[model samples]
Target: MDSKNYIDSGILELYVYGALSEKESMEVSQALQQHPEIRAEVEAIERSLTQLSTAAAPYQPDQVYQQIKTKLNFKDQEVAMIPITRKRTNWPAYIGWAASVALLIGLFIQFDKNKELRQEVVQSQIEKNLLEGKIQVAEEDLTKTKTILSVLRNKDVIEVPLQAQQVAPEAYAAVYWDKESQTAYIDVAGLPTPPPGKVYQVWSLKLDPLTPTSLGTLDSFNEEATKVFALNNANESEAFGITLEPEGGSESPTMEQLYTLGVVNS
Candidate 1:
């Protein structure tokens, strides 16, 4: 495993706590030698645990001795020393063992809390990113809506409604032509969704000579929520037509696949 995955696996904590079996401990030791990062992590864990244990265990030898003497009912007066071998409570040993247990419990609790905190931070970041992405998308949509509204309200813009052709009787679309800016905003909301591997290509037509100029393909048709697209049109277009073409469009209009057509009002 990589160093990061190895460190995150919690085995290093167990190794430091001496809770791992002999074989596992040997393996960890090998890793510690091979990986500097693992060694550093182990050292850091050891330092933290040592600090916690030390802070929790305050050593007051004199106080402990006095307390022990008080508990034993001992007096300062000198008396004959006699060795009595009887079962007695080992208070010092018991206190040391209890302190060790408490230290271990405290370390375990701290480890668990730290893990929870890390998880919370990661989850919070994910949520934050998702919210930001949504906000960005909303902002872009708002900008597009504002631009479209402005175009529609312009007095100089020419509106042409492209009626459904025989190929697709139910499919219709409209074009807002701004001659000043040479921009054509086509609203394809009334048109049916294009099938897979096919796209809707727009054309600027001159009906007098039946000449067709390719504006562009609606490549982002499926992704566009408003079903509106803007394409550059510098040609003196007398008419507009939409045709279904293969992906990336074609060099010439496929007249048989024409979905909509409309002539500019004189």
Candidate 2:
């Protein structure tokens, strides 16, 4: 039943008066637990019943002392004597309530501890996932590195070493050409980092009549982790050359800014 309906039904008064069956009383106890309004109503009824019982019951046990003193021949002192009664401290009631309060406090402390432990467990799981993701990325990078290394170290690949040129004497680079795949992998690890507003552009030189075909530009030179770049090369390249060109690269090799050059040995 709803709180309002249950309260108006007068079952709470019966429950408090011990007039209800055990099952009915249990039902009321459960309702009181679920609804604060029902609990409040039941408490008010219990208080009223207690007050009625107290008022009806003879509260003066002092009359017994008066009769005892009269029988002991204290009749002359009766007229001048004042009645005094000291209420005994209910130790059993105090201990029972104190124990109940202690138990409630212990439960509250345990609940807080459990909540903290659960949060710690959740945080640990988040950290574990983060670590696992990093490990996965590291493994992927390792696999990529191994694959690139194997391609560069292939016996059939033609290795061309480009020497430093006039524009940048300290710069150097190497090209690993796969004739079958018509591709070239340029290892620019030895090349000096490019200046701002400029990038390193590679070329496939025919050497005869000085024909230089644009291969591609190393756009992310500084950002590349391995400093190796891949380019499609279908030309019958007789030589390879690298030049420092404007950011987007030049239509042809910038002869003045030529950083490295190497002729392929047929």
Cα lDDT of all candidates, in order? 0.85, 0.81
Model 1, 1-266: lDDT tens digits are 59998987676765665445677778999999999999999999878756655555554444544553464455544111422222333334556788889999999999999999999999999999999999999999999999999999999999999999999999899999999999999999999989999999999999887999999999999899999999999999999999999999999999999999999997
- Candidate 1 error regions (>4 Å): 1-109
In terms of lDDT, the best-performing candidate is 1
* TM-score for each model: 0.60, 0.53
- Lowest summed-lDDT stretch of 10 residues in model 1? 78-87
Residue 85, model 1: Cα distance from true site in angstroms:
15
The RMSD of every model to the true structure, in order and in angstroms, is 20.4, 17.0
